[model samples]
Target: MQNREQLWLELPPMSPEAPRRLLVFLHGAGSSPEAFAPVALAWQLKFPGAQAAILQGPEAHPGGAAHDWFDTRAVAADRAERAALAAARLAQRVAVLQQSTGVDAERTVLVGFSQGATVALEMVRNRPGLAAIVVAYAGRLARPIRSGERLDATVHLLHGEFDSLVPVVHAHQALRALHASGTEATLDIVADSGHVIDQQLIILGTTRVMQTVFRGRRRAAGDGRTLH
Candidate 1:
């Protein structure tokens, strides 16, 4: 299995005052929270009062000190079913976390890599508006979304052009799917890269986040203006 790695992680959302932003990060298959904390923290730094969580996958992946959200060896149909159920469970977890952290779905962000990315996308696919944004790295859409479903969050898909494991085509296909569903989304493919996250990818992801956050604020402001 491919091993992956991410920093002081402060989960102090339980403070008397609720945080304004919530970030939930998920590592790839055969990875743990300890391996993805740094990446999660990187995003948190951009959003003040944003509490972050590097969540561990629920199941143990055999032959390693890693965890998986669902079985990867199952047949395609079975794997899809398993992933959907996993996403459902995760959505529930997010709801509870939001209540405790005082972060509403509109202020929440979900970031995941590879299989973790699949689950993150799946959850929002099942719910349509579970969080305000999802930043998927080197991952594809695991389940089919209904046509023209109302997407409450914008999705950003980032992939490595030379990623053999997940292939860049998946990102293209996912973007198409999201577009057909009337969801606000974007895709960025990094050249000369593989399945792993590197400095270039990190910088690219940060740029996407900044653009989306600011654009959302502008739209919200426009909506609040009085019409003549």
Candidate 2:
């Protein structure tokens, strides 16, 4: 269970009243908000004007003292329903953040790792357009997304080719599911990588967020240039 004293870790934006983007990060099983807070902080440097929130799972991870979004030991059939519930709760949390920070769904991004990614993916089904983009690392769908339940946000699925913990096949399956549902999804396989987030994945995530956040915007005539 989450420690009532510390529910989440947050990196406030440089400008509380105005910010360019927001990132919501979810940690893997047996992990706490602390596990992903560093990366979330580092993103401030990478994205320049973004705030980040590292959310802790509501339930305690069965493996240890860390937290988990859903009980990993639950029957496979029940896992999906549990994940759906988690998604609903998380959407409410995100709404609070959005209201307090003024970062709407259009300017926010959802990023998750492993089991956390599964819950994030579930959120896409539960609340479409909850964010502009979602980046899932070393994760897969806990259950298949049904037809007519299309995800509205752009999704980037990254997995290590040599990831033994989750296996790369899961990424492929997720890609198929998202594509079938007509979501804008991309599957990027990192060669020789393991079930871990590396510099490459971080850069890719940053770039994707920037791209989605700035897509279709017109720059001023005098503007030198932008990465996009």
Best by lDDT: 2
Over all chains combined, what TM-score does candidate 2 have?
0.89
How badly does each model clash, as a count of residue pairs? 3, 1
- Give one digit per residue, the lDDT tens place, for model 2 in 1-228: 135633888787765444467788999988988778777876777766677889988888775889888887878889888888888899888888888777788778899999889888888778877887889999989788786878888899998889999999999998998899898898888898999998888888778766665553444223755422
Give lDDT per model, in order: 0.81, 0.82
lDDT of 2 at 100: 79
Residue 162 of model 2 has an lDDT of: 98
Stretches of candidate 1 exceeding 4 Å from the true structure: 1-10, 13-19, 225-228
How many Å off is the CA of 185 in candidate 2?
A: 0.9
Q: What is candidate 1's TM-score against the reference?
A: 0.88
Candidate 1, residues 1-228, lDDT tens digits: the string is 122312113454433343368888888999888888777766655664678877777778889978898988778778888989989988887787789777788888898899999999988888866798998999998866676675678899999999999999999999998888788899999889999888778777778877887787787788995311
lDDT: worst 10-residue window of model 2: 219-228
